[model samples]
Target: MSGNFKMLAKTLYGFEPILAKELRNLGAGNVEEGVRNVTFDGDTGFLYKANLCLRTALKIMKPISRFRVFSEKELYRQVYDIDWSDLFDHDKTFAIDTTMNSEVFNNSLFVSQRAKDAIVDKFRATTRQRPNVNTHDPDIRINIHLYKNSCTVSLDSSGTSLHQRGYRISTNIAPINEVLAAGLLLTSGWNGTTDFLDPMCGSGTFLIEAAMIACNVPANINRSSYSFMHWNDFDDELYEKIIAASLNKTREFHHKIIGYDKAPSATRKAQENVDNANLSEYITIERKDFFRTEKPVDTKLHMVFNPPYGERLQIDVEDFYAKIGNTLKQNYPGTNAWLITSNLEALKYVGLRPSRKIKAFNGKLESRLVKYEMYEGSKKAKYKTDTQ
Candidate 1:
């Protein structure tokens, strides 16, 4: 393996440990968990593998340079010191994204502009032509992180965010992000041992992610592009070998993965997305109101879903949540049901005391991932309330 370098994988809140564990399992060296990112050492092939297989990662970045800067001039000098031509050609278009948490840099846009100037100047001095900056779509995407007086410049190896797995061409209203979906499933400890279900399976994100986890399928198997592919040092043969090896590691899944949605359009979209992900063999979607359905499986089932949170969909939040509780208590037995919702007021109407409640965020909204365990042959779940 050539070009063994340190890479940082960014993830959502409460997922650092899982991301670190995943990196270690993937044979990454020096796997260290940061606030919302994981740092690891891997070669180019390993980078491709990480981007393709990491379910919880939102982006994988390859750091090219690091320096200290107390002022704008120092920042420009530091940015210019790096050999930009070594990373990409002058013919390519590039964009700079900056994240600043420092006293020296006031505005991230200004920092990006300075960084861009340094790179363009370097390119012009070397090749007599500078790469144009394309903010929307760029051949090379550079990331600048300024913490206090220290700065880290990295190449965005996963160009368009790993969440765009390329399989979800169709989506229903309030469709969850693929990376978030995978992280939530991982957090719930879904390991393919039990049957899986997503009652309000809008676009079947949970079902598809669950099936992939159960079958040991790579997370970004359907994704076609990566930022590293445009890098100057990219090796086609090595990347192809990594893909082939990853595909070879996919295992068999036995348990059933089911999805139910009240809306026929949602069910159809989920089915189409599932089929697009090549997971139709492991997942099944049906148009049925979850409130009207019973536990389909005889064995212990693991259920996870995101119900209508009253933000996007128009529904009586109180009644909808109460019905969810009623359905689980009356029909679902021998099941571990987990749901994420931001509607705190509606959660009270569920009429169930969650056995476990984990604080989480659905995008910017503060949310809770509550769990309800319904024992076998028991009419009431662990968290039944008399309010119903």
Candidate 2:
């Protein structure tokens, strides 16, 4: 537990609570949830585990400095006061990414430039050398956040976003983000208790995430690297032990995980991605139009998928959504179908009344994750009749 420090795990909007819960379950101390971020205390090994296990987090950051500033000069002064050379050597490259919602700073890019100047000047003053800035691929990523007069500087422990789980090499068009797909599955109350399905399985993200969640498999089991691995204090032995211990906790999943897509290419990509994740044993992919297929299982089924939103796909939106409703109502029984879509106009065409509708975002488009329950018997699903 040496090198234990505070870390912040950043996530998307509305995912802070789930990320915080995940942190607590993973033995994080002083877990506090912020807007799109969660702060907690853990050691270097825990940092590795957090990156490996957190399904909702986009990145994990380690805060190095926090100070109040009244002016731009003060910002540069405070940033320069930090002993930058002690944190990393001048031989290593670094990059600064800044976020600002304050009156003191007009542009986040300017703030980042000033901060980088301070760090570079400090390094040159001490070692007579300056680390080159490699924005695309840096050895160390520095995050600067300024709100009003308060500012915090942290090291980005996760280099690329944690959504790059390294298992999804092949992706279909409009394949959902890995973190968003996992969060949607979690919010739908999917816990591997019964059979699972992704009717419009684009690259099988939901199916793979569901299988991993059910099997207690580490989220980043296939990921090969993290920003922390390049840090000066990274301990190889400790990291290896952490990986082994996490893998030891993996449990068995008895229920089935299934995926289906009308497009043959999508089905093929999903199969390849599942195989890359080494999860073919737990997932099955089929190339069948969801509307033409029935619920494959008799028992209660948990289903989640992202149907085409009609933004890029050249399909008749109303007809497609109506077919989805008809297929679910008449064929899929004993199933809880959860789908995320941004087509509000098309959603009305579904005809079946959604039991629950939660607001979510599919990338930049605001969407809703609606749930439709199909009972086991011949009870007609309730529908809202037009009064006008």
Candidate 3:
């Protein structure tokens, strides 16, 4: 809790730049991008703000110590030397999550176990009582990262992943991760300048995220808790002030954010999620087949969605994906459409080349985020040539 301290915001594989930009926009100093994380300088207040505002970030970690390690004994000794009681009480529960990229540490589980043992042993030696491990829902979450034999111990300020924005309780067959949805929207340049649409919106994830972006709402405004709240130095008043200041930054959104789905159940659940997010005013959900309908608005439109990749859902992958392209080419004019899908082979049948193709991951599946530019008369020219 110094005036300014170094912090890291972890994100997805290709989201370092977006997260870095977010940190800088949030007034972070010395913002530098790493593999899947961004290092920056921010005070405790900024830490709370980052956790509240950053949409692309997965976790915000505060480094406590970093040291060189060779074997298990050294790891245990180093971990045991830390003053654990200064952070939290013995009555609280904690958990360690280890990520090892070193040849010395063959197993991440063993490293986590060794670190846990050292922490519990240190507590026992000091207070004759030790905190129990709560792997599922820990009061305090510790992060251990070992790369090329150098180990860094950090406290996970975000107890759960930031993607858990606490707004989505009802989900359809396959819902996109909230963080991924936000990152993709940001990458597609959805800054709320124009109208937004998620044509195949399932449960309205993209629609809600779009509404929040349009309104400049804090990403975690609906969330009520974080790991930092469990720390011994937790400041309730400071957090309240932070939340108040963040709420002050929200602005009114004039444009509409719309969602459409063929299934009635999907539309119903999407409206429920929209209500959960408190964004019903800015968003609208409808039950309609995208391929059978024309553009809802006459002005320029921005679209982002994650269609079924045929991984968990049963469908004709080629036909489904081709219909997406066909519908857009025929009906959606003057629109910038972006879609993410892991079905690479099926993507070939879309009958249009993507203007931009970015590699991304939907959970463990490797996916591509592609953009299609639909001009006012591009489809007419294609049909005219065929008729000739």
Which sections of candidate 1 miss by over 4 Å? Answer: 1-3, 379-388
Model 1, global lDDT: 0.90
Name the runs in model 2 displaced over 4 angstroms: 1-4, 379-388
229-344 per-residue lDDT for model 1 (tens digits):
88888888988888899999999988899999988899999999999999998998999999889999999999999998989989999899999999998999888999999998
C-alpha lDDT of all candidate models, in order: 0.90, 0.90, 0.93
Query: By lDDT, is 1 or 3 better?
Result: 3
Backbone clash total, candidate 1:
0
TM-score of each: 0.96, 0.95, 0.96
Q: Per model, how many backbone clashes are there? A: 0, 0, 0
Per-residue lDDT of model 3, residues 1-388, tens digit only: 6699999999998999999999999999999999999999999999999999999999999999899999999999999998999989999899999998997988999999999999999999999999999999999999999998899999999999999999998998879999999999999999998888899999999999988888889999999899999988888899899999988999898787989999999999999999999999999899999989898998899999998888898989889888999998889998999999999998898998899999999999999999999987866796787799
Better of 2 and 3 by lDDT: 3
- In model 2, what lDDT does residue 225 have? 86
